[model samples]
Target: MARFLGRRLLVAIPVLFGVVVLVFLILRLIPGDPAQIVLMGTNASPERVAQVRHQMGLDQSWFSQFVIYVGGLLRGDLGYSYISHGTVAAQIGSRLPSTIDLAAAALAVALIVGVPTGIIGGFWPGSIGDKLATGFSVLGLAVPYFWLAQLLILLFAVDLRWLPALGVGGPTALILPALSLGLGFAAIITRILRSALIDVYQQPYIIVARSKGLSNWHVLTRHALRNATSSVTTIIGLQIGNLLAGAVATEVIFGRPGIGNYLVSQIQLKDIPSIQGIVLFIALCYIVINILVDVSHGMLDPRVRKAWAS
Candidate 1:
């Protein structure tokens, strides 16, 4: 277990480093000067722009800037956000909880809705229920989240007047955004889980369990679910990554407080430090989520744990 964790951590180092470099380089390509944005107006003369650039270390060559940024990262510094006039980490921390809460609620909804639908689809692959589920999952995947978010707002908040149109209203406010965000994730989960369960059902052990006179539900719950969930666990982590990636649009649409909303605001404001910081944080979130999924995989399957042990 220790060795497996160490290996995962070791692997994450390079992935994270690559992400930092990629985001650093990509953000610079966003058109317009970070220095100009920082200096605040087009009226600043070239000399003044140069002075501000020098002060912000934007005057350094791209490679030098990358090195400096990485050096700060190694020391646990995410740099300062000129927009917020504070440390980037601090800014993200203040809004992190809301984003996490939103993502968590969305994930729970996905699991609740997706898992059963998947099982039913796998249990009767050619039945009408399966066909309907298949169509629903496909539609879920096809629809854009921003558009769905609007539809949700229109239906629940505007027309029905059951939910708030914007801002956080405790759990009720959480519902629409979560539903919008999670429907797509649930669609994807249902398909993947259905596939996994179908494959599990065809395995030798499944036949053996039936031969032992186990009830179908007992076999599914005790035997199939545990085996199939290893794959489902991976999807859960990927869903989190997707959820956070989609968060900017969702938060903006709903007027919610989260890293996504903060990030979009900073980008439109052309706050380079904040952009880099937030992108890095999002990348780190992906890495952490995937690592946790891998750990869950081992827990779900003793073979995986043994493989790691050896």
Candidate 2:
């Protein structure tokens, strides 16, 4: 297991490097000079423009600038934001907590809502419970997140005055954003969990459990659930990436302050450093989540550990 983890970590470094390179080059490809954008808002002289460009390292050759950025990254400095005029690491650090909080809450809701629906539906396939669960899952999958957020705002915020339209206040503030994010993930989880449950139920041990006069709940919670956890864990691990991406859209729609909101504003202002920082932070989050997923596979299933050991 330790060897497998070491190999995974070894592989992740190059993947992260590739993601950084791709994201950096793609941002550069987009036609807009960050210095020019900054100058457009001010009555700056040519010297001033040159100064801003020099400070941002835009006056340097692209290769030179790339080297500087790579060097700074290696030293754990994300660089200064060209627009905000602040350290990229500090700016991201401030907003990251909120995004993480929101994403974690949404994923928790997805798991809580999705797993039960799937288990019940799969345990009694084609029953009324199954149909209801499937229908709800369809609704979740079909609804667009932004549209749902807006509708929620209208119904709960405007019409009924039950919750704030935007900006988190309390537990109530979480409901709308969580719902907006969770519904889609819940649908995905439901499909994955249902399939896994179906497969687990077909195993001979399940039949033995049934024949041994075990209650349905006991069999499910113990025998079937143990075997099914790895699949559900895999789905959850994969969805961490989606959750992070969705946070940007959700934060914008809900008027919440998070890394996504900060990113959108920075992109509009053509803050190259901020853009690079945000993408890098997101990439790091993805890599870390994947690592967690790998560890979870071994933790949730001894068979996986045994296979790795072999």
The candidate scoring highest on TM-score is 2
**Model 1: per-residue Cα lDDT over 1-310, one tens digit each:** 8899999999999999889888788656767887787657457889988986886678789888888888988887887875678999999999999999889988888888888888888888899878877887899899998999999999998999999979996899899999999888989889988889899999999999999999999999999988988999988887788899888899999999999999999878778888888889888888998999999999999899989978
Where model 2 places Cα greater than 4 Å from the true spot, the runs are none
Q: What is candidate 1's CA lDDT for residue 262?
A: 96
Cα miss at 40, model 1 (Å)? 3.0
Instruction: Give the TM-score comparing model 2 with the true structure, all chains together.
Output: 0.94
Candidate 1 pairs with clashing backbones: none
User: Per-prediction TM-score, please?
Assistant: 0.92, 0.94
lDDT of 2 by residue, 14-122 (tens): 9998987876675467677666766666777888888888886777888998888788888888868656778989998898878877898899889889989988788
Q: Please report, in order, the local distance difference test score of every candidate based on alpha carbons.
A: 0.87, 0.85
For model 2, give the 10-residue run with minimal summed lDDT.
Answer: 26-35
